[model samples]
Target: MENSLNSIFISLYAQRIQVLFAVIGVTITCLVLYCYRKRKPGICGNLRFSKVAYNSITVDWDRACYTTHYRVFLRKPLEGEKWRSFKTKNDTCSFTIKNLPINTNFVFSVCACNGTVQGPLCKESEVISTQNLAFKMKGISILREETLPNYIPVYDVPFRVERNGQLKVRKVTIGDYPKGGAHQVKSILFVSIPHSGHTTHLQGVMNFIFGVSTKDDFRLGFSSDITKKSDEYKNWATVYQFVEYEGGRLDKPLTLVDIPRMHGPKKEQLMMIHEQLKYILELYEQRLDCICFVGPANSNNLSPEEIDFLESIMYLFPNDQSSDLSTDISCFFTFADAGPACLENGLKSSSVKNFKSYFVNWSAFFRETNEFSDSFWNMNIKSLDNFFNHLNASKPKTLRLTLEGEPPAPQKKENVWKLQPEVKEDVANLQMTKTNGENFIDNKTKLTYNLQFFVYNGGNQTN
Candidate 1:
């Protein structure tokens, strides 16, 4: 009986050993398979998304450097939503699971593939418990260096969209007038004409005459149009024609509209300038000796004909305040054009007194002519501060037609259509190098000067 029992026990023990080995073999196979599976990143990029309530989630690898295809699988709730697994290639780094009914937690992992070859899924996908993941979102960080000043309008959108929105914005004038006007009854501010000197010169004169700005602005002018209402409370104080926009100072910000107008020609450029000068004269008409102010020589860009034409304008509106701001205004002449230079270019005849410079003493012109006063430094006159001085001494009146009051009436329709003279040539006594002195210029500069004046004065001058 003992022998038989021993045999049975031995057989059973051997069976048990075989079964244990088979189980170990299966476990090893499963471990190897898990190790070989590949996966991909479930969340992508440095950007933060808005808060939302969701179960399963996916991501895109559209950033630089990543090229391999991936398959994603979520383990449990990583933080926010309930996690779930999904499939995607390198081409499709994004996915959407159709069903995620429970609010269970999860972890996610991605599997990378190279077409024929499959890789292992990532280990321990992050937890994404729907209950634990809060719905609230954190605020995003703003890039301070990239943002514009607080005063300017700003919005969060595509760059193009933001640009369009800015274009549509209308300025809301604060503190005072939505539209401002020229302060005086008349003004004589000079606006830029073409082919003028560089901004360095113009700006220097502008600052000297206008003074440092109290507040830098796009322009100094009056309202474009104002229709006075019977109800003064409702109506504006004054209406004015639009003048040239002054533009930003040397150091300041510029708007888009200003950007082009400052550098490019506008439809109303010439007209606007004319209107500005006219407005200024109107504002300070009675306050000064002259209603007009002309910058002498224009740094030598203007030709004799051009200067003569400018003088004629003085004659055209002889009655305008610009015509006479001097004492005993008749036979106008003065020492204003005297040159103090040691070496006079002897270019005096061009600076002779005329009907426009009528206020200046005729003797002054003769003296300067004899001396050949050519340096602008010596010839400049002290500007008349307030025309009141001359106005008080001699109550000057608007110069009326001393000659044919009304020029011969226009001929007819055909005559009206004939090109009217916009600019007049200086056709007067032409002198030799003696009184007027000869024009001094090298070949290159002469051509440049000639072409420039021709465009403006049509090649004309007067002695």
Candidate 2:
């Protein structure tokens, strides 16, 4: 009986140990889950300003987990104003705060939200001041007084192809007037071969600029309806102009030029294509700020015609070896939704790789499924926003308009004038006399003398 009692005690002890181990395992799992819950949710970071204008500030951030949408807060901290909050669509990582007062400092912050629950605010916020129009006007005045005389008013001339196959430029006021009138205007040109997703890329850029996704309501200026189907003009170039304003003042004006596909099977057809391009260049005076080459992401290599077209553009606007940052040539590989492997393969083509080595101003490969889904549209829009932001920051080298057979004008070499000791002394004396209002010559004579001196010494100048 004692032995039987000992055996029962042993069995009971074993059962107790087993139960304790099961409890420990449950506790460990609970602890792990608690730690994960604490670490994973509501960690949005890297709030940054994507674009700042006279009346709007666009902010973007890294995506956060468990976020249904994001809340952006704007306030004038110095004025002690209440924080104004704007909520973005679900899963959106960027927001534009519009109609803000110009020349005023404002603070911006972002936080992730899951329904009624708010996550932690971004670790840091940015302070930005809206562009002041008075300062801008002053800068414009300075530019007009000191810079080149080629500053043509934006969108004052329109290029039209007459029925007789002649290109004509007519003076016509075009585009919408921003509330206060646009202080800055930028123009972009798109070039591509047929079946290269050029139209789709242009449409995406338009959607981003107009802040609209649908083509049904896409209109430029008063007329120029984009929704209408135009099969007859499919082979012709199209121009689009738009204006952005805030508080009845112009914020920015933008122009887009869509060149027809550069593809021709016959010699005459090729000649016609070249002639059209030449006319367009003449109309714009070759002052385009950006030139984007669009291609399909599915293509393995560029066609011979496409290669020739790219060469033509490069010849017209040769790369500026003097400065690495002055190139205006950009490349866009559209219809890239085929996944990463396909995109990589397409970029590896000999023609694409060779072109990228030289035309490296900016490049983007984006998916264009032409889908109505909000997610897809947002993704592409973000990519375009990045592209434009980069373009705006970089200064593009100026281009000279040239015809098919005419050679591009030689790049102007910077003249370095090394004056002789006697000439330098004379120049110093002249400057001092001019400043002192003594021994001053007549304005005409002085100008004539200066021109003669420069012309006589021009041969001695070094590049």
Candidate 3:
């Protein structure tokens, strides 16, 4: 009797457990179907934006629980630009119409969904049109002027060491071969610009200074930082720093060569740099063979005479915003040829009276039948080797005008024409050339460039 009773109890308990599990599974299935069928109608929450456009507000939707994508529609509130939509086979719930012109009224709607079904859009999100709305742009970042063409050099600054503990150069953050020289010191300038070239030169210097000779000493500068501008300069040459401080970063010299014309920098920036060099040069004894200016070579900022004095060191690197720092400053006021390296045998650029500015048409492309491509002109100095014999800082001006573009009007016959308000070049400027071969000194006292402006239409003979 006891055995029979025990068997009946165990069977009843097993049946109850099975029924309980069955009920729980059904409940879960019901919930899954409810969520799937809910179509997940995303929240528009009445489209919102930082600002309203014309009469419309932006649309926003929730992307939660979405598998595939979303869709956006714009309407004229009634018959607008015809339900225009953005395809979103993927998941997205937000869309912005950035160029929605000003002073227009429009309505926009958006919705999101799973691959199986789409949830209904809640409240058209936001209706937007930029009518009567005050269009105020957000704050924009103003880049430092250093970011411009006058690129600053990269740096690998040693903890500003001193001869007797006097800091010769400030701790900072810091290119190429070139013409005309003496003593054959086998000197290669590792230069630095205020912003660009310094890093490269520093790296070059470090490798040589701590290379095989001090192979084990490499661990010292292990903590020293070097950028590309400084890396190329290691050990090959001495470095000097001239920049003081501009917003904490070094304030490298400004040059006219990069600016090209008065449009380059404000009249004040020229004076600022002129005064800067005047003061900076005072720190050093005029001795180094080359005062490697690792900076831009354009004469738009510096005068022809000023640049000649700077190059009085050696190798006459056309651009060396990257000044050097070395104990031995021996060579001073020596001339190594500083003209265009590629232009040695022939003229590279021909001036054209085409645009208001003197259009320098390079001969390498025109004469060689080389099709000019944008990428070609963007190359470094080596890429430009075929065209420059080294840029002639004091080359005589010959207006080589192309017969293309607008028809040549005959009213202009002067060799140099004054620039008009519409154009950037000043054609009326006098043609100034350097006198006294290697010792050209600028007595102008003013930090201004005399652009040898010329009239393209008329020959110099008439002007």
TM-score of each: 0.22, 0.42, 0.23
> In model 2, what lDDT does residue 117 have?
71
Candidate 2 local lDDT, 198-244, one digit each (tens): 64465445434534332221111112333244666555665655443
Q: Candidate 3 lDDT (Cα, whole model)?
A: 0.32
Candidate 2, poorest ten consecutive residues by summed lDDT? 356-365
lDDT for each of the candidates?
A: 0.31, 0.55, 0.32
Rank candidates, TM-score, best first. 2, 3, 1
Residue-level error in angstroms, candidate 1, position 17: 88
**lDDT for predicted candidate 1 compared with the true structure:** 0.31
Candidate 2: regions farther than 4 A off: 1-165, 168-175, 179-182, 213-235, 245-251, 263-285, 322-328, 341-348, 351-375, 403-463
Instruction: Give candidate 3's error at residue 150 in angstroms.
Output: 22
Candidate number with greatest lDDT: 2
Better of 1 and 2 by TM-score: 2
Q: Which ranking of candidates, highest lDDT first?
A: 2, 3, 1
Candidate 1 wrong stretches, greater than 4 Å: 1-186, 189-202, 209-302, 319-348, 351-463
Q: All predictions: root-mean-square deviation over Cα?
A: 24.6, 23.9, 24.0
